[model samples]
Target: TEADPLADAVAAAVAEANEPQPSAPTGPPLPGGEKDAFRVAVGQCWNVGSLSTDALGTTVVVAVAMQETGVPDGGSIRMLSFSGGSEAAALQAFEAARRAIIRCGARGFPLPVEKFSQWRDIEMTFNPEGMQFR
Candidate 1:
């Protein structure tokens, strides 16, 4: 009887441990209503078409580090990762992502100042295939 009780407790513990747990949010979700704002801000500043006509189906992950002052450090914006249709496409993706930062960074991302703390670091995926952010 004692062994049966012990086995049941062990089984229950194992099941509890195996139960799925929600993942922690990687970075702050763009505040409500700011999604469009962020998109527009990046789009207006992004000019990578000339950089890579071959980057038709490429995606680049850009990481932006937000300072407490609501401004991104000059060297904080960088390419975290990328995927492309080809080797050349991958290069183009990086170029395009870099250019976006150079052009749009001077004015700082259009992120709301109040929410800067939430997005201390933002890893955004730029998908040129659909010209959308993921």
Candidate 2:
């Protein structure tokens, strides 16, 4: 089959989206290292008490587009993919993920204003394995 430019472009875009993000440039380092800072900021509001056991154990990758001002574009928040549970359970997990982002980030994350491009969009994996349940 001949190479389709549109297909190739879409594939490249998908590949770039799935790749891990580069770390922030050197300056004021985030409190818990560069990468983990994103996690710690959003993870604090992840309340799993109401989630099912299956949901709590599942990992869901959530994606969101952001404004330059550090606020996540509300309509862009969505679950990209999930595993280790039924779709129903994954939905539960995704809701928790959504809540965490919306709750803790209502005022927007404390990302550096100058480096907005670095975080204009992000996909974060919410894995419950490391969380401590009550």
Choose the strongest candidate by lDDT.
2
TM-scores, all models, native as reference: 0.62, 0.72
Expressed as tens digits, the lDDT of each residue in 3-86 for candidate 1 is 688888999999989876534333456666786666667666666557556676778778877665545565877777767667
lDDT tens digits, residue span 1-134, model 2: 89999999999999999886665443343344655776787878888889899998799999998776778888899999999999999999999989888888888887876666566778999888865434
RMSD after CA superposition, every candidate: 7.2, 8.8
Off by over 4 Å in 1: 1-29, 132-134
**Model 1, residue pairs in steric clash:** none
| Whole-model lDDT values for every prediction | 0.67, 0.82
**Model 2 bad stretches (over 4 Å):** 1-32
lDDT value for model 1: 0.67
Estimate the TM-score for candidate 1: 0.62
